[model samples]
Target: MSFSPDRSQASEAAPVTGSAPGSASGAFAIATQGLSKRFGNRTAVDGLTIGIPAGTIAGFVGPNGAGKTTTIRLLLGLVRPNAGSATILGHPLTASPSYLPRVGALIEAPAFYPSLSGRTNLEVLARLGGYPTSRVSELLEVVELSDRARDRVGTYSLGMKQRLGVAMALLPDPDLLILDEPANGLDPLGIIGIRDLLRRVREQGKTILLSSHLLGELEQVTDWLIMLHQGKALTCGSTRDLLAQRGELVVEAGDAMQLDLVARIVSEADYVVTREDRTLHIACPATFAETLNRQAREAGATNLTIRVKEASLEQLFLALVKGDRS
Candidate 1:
C-alpha cells in the first residue's frame, strides 16, 4: 500500500546517473539504512542495513518468520518502514515510480486469471501496466512457456504457473529482479530449469535478489548473502568471505583421555572446542590442522585422525543463527 507514488514530482527527481555498476563510486543496486517494520506487538524487520551490488546474484535467506518477506516488501516499497530509508538504483522509495519501471518482482505465489490462457493473461497484464504487447512472445520463450502459451492457467501445473509468473514479471524488461521462493514446490526438473533461467538472466548483466528455503539450490546461484534471524540482520557479506573466514578441524583420538587432553591443548591455543564422544571439533583456520595433529602426537594420543573440513553455506547459516541466539 505504501508503494503508491506522488505522481506529480516522482519523475522530477534528477535522472539517475553516475552510479552504474563498477563505476568508481562502487554504487549498489539496492541500499538500505536502518530499515525497520512492525505490526502490532511484533517487529518484523529491525534496523536492517545492507547493500546489494549490481550484476550479482544475492541470496536473501532466513528461517521461517525471520522477516525475509517483510524485508522484501519494504525494499519494493509495498510496505513503508517505521524508520530508516531505502533506495533502489539510487532512487528513494517515494520516487520509485521513476525507477521501479526498470525493476521486476515475483513475490510469494503470484495469481493469474485461471480461466485465461497463459499468453492471454500476460497480454492483459501488459495492457494494464502499459507495457508493449510485443514482449509477450519474447518472454514466454525466455521462461520456456512458449509451448504452453495457449494453455489455460487452470490447466497448468504449479511449475508452469510459476514460469508464467516469471514471464509476467519480465514484460517490462527490468534491470533488477526480486524473486521470493521462485523454487518453492518445484520438482527436481523444475528447480533445475529455474536455476538455469536465473543463470541466463545474470549473463544478460541483470542483478537479482533471490529468497528461498532451498539452501542447497540457493548456494548454487548466489555470490552474496544477507542472512536474517528474529527480524534482525545476523550477518551480511560476500558468500565466499563468510564461508572461508573459518573452518572446522575434526580430530578423533584413540581414547577418552586423549580426547580430553586434545581439547585442553586446543583450547589453550585459543581455539573453541566441541567434544562428541572421542571426537574433538575445533573451530579454527584450516592452516591450524598441522599444529593440532602435532600437539595430539606430543601428548601421546595415538590413532588420532585429524582432518580439516570446510563449512558449507548451510553450515555457516546454522552456525550464525545459533550463535546470535546464544
Candidate 2:
C-alpha cells in the first residue's frame, strides 16, 4: 500500500525552486509555470500555470480545444513545451526520467487485447513495465475485477475496461495518477463506480489528477479544481472555495407582473437578475433567500415560489469561461 520510493533514487537535477511562486517545491505534486505549446500558428497551451497539491483529487476540466490533452502530453513528456517549466514529483520537466516511473497515467481509451483475459492483459503490462507480477492480482482486487479476472477483455463492459485501465495504472504503485475522462461513455452506475474507486485510490495516499468533462461527477469527488480554457488555467482552487463564490435565487410568480416586480426588487438591490418567461433568476447569496421571499410577499405577490440554488460545477464552468472570453 506504500507508494513512497527511496529518496536516494530521486533526481540529482536539483528540485525545482519556487516554480509556483510563494509556494515551496514540496507543496505540489504537480506544478507548472508559463508552460506553452504550439502547433504552427495555433497555440494549444498558452503560458499555462497550475499547482495540484499532493494527495488530493484535482479535477482538470475544460471545453474542447482548451489544451487539456496538450498539457497532459507535456506533463508526460510526450511532447516538449514551447515555453515555461514544470515539475512532477519534485523533479523538473527536464528530468522526467527521474519522476515518470512514479507517475501513472491513463489518457483516452485504454487499448487491450480483446482475446486475452483481463488478468493476462495486466500480467503482460506488468512484465513489460518491470513491475511486480503480484501487483496484478492486487490491482484486480482493487478494481473489483477479481471475479471477472479470467474473463476475456472483449467480454468486459466499458466500465470494466476502464477499471482494468486503472488497474494497469496502479500496477506501477504510482504516487500520482493522471486519468483523462475515465468516466466517459459510462452509464450513471459506471460513473459512480469510478468515483468510488478514485476515493479508494486517494485513501491509499495517492494524488490523482482527473481530467473529465463530467462536472457533476467531478464536483462530487474532487477536493481541488483546475479549470482550463484556451490552453490556460482560468481558475484553480479548492472546490469549496470556487463554488462558494456564486449562488442564485430562483423565483417564480403566478403572474408576469409579479415576476417583473421581483426582478426589479432584486435588480434595485444591486443583485444581477435575469428573466426567463415566468422565472426570475437572481444572482445573489443563498443567505438572501429568506429576505427575498419576504420581499416578494410584501410586494403584494400572492402566489410566489422561491428557491436558493448553490452554484454547480457546470454553472461555475460556464461563468468562468464566459468571463474569460469577455
Best by lDDT: 2
lDDT by residue (tens digit), candidate 2, 40-145:
9999999987888899999988878888888999999999999999999999999999999999999999999999999999999999999999888889999999
lDDT of 1 by residue, 1-326 (tens): 01111111111112121122234223688877778899988999988877788898988888889999998998787998998877788788678788889999999998999999999999999999999999899889889989989989999999899888888878888889999989889998998988888888888888989998777887777877777788877666666555544467778777788888888889899878998887788886565666667777788876677776655768877877677221
Off by over 4 Å in 2: 1-21, 249-308, 324-326
Per-model C-alpha RMSD: 11.4, 10.2
Model 2: ten consecutive residues of lowest lDDT? 1-10
TM-score of each: 0.79, 0.79
lDDT of 2: 0.83
Candidate 1: worst 10 consecutive residues by lDDT? 1-10
Q: List the residue pairs that clash in candidate 1.
A: none
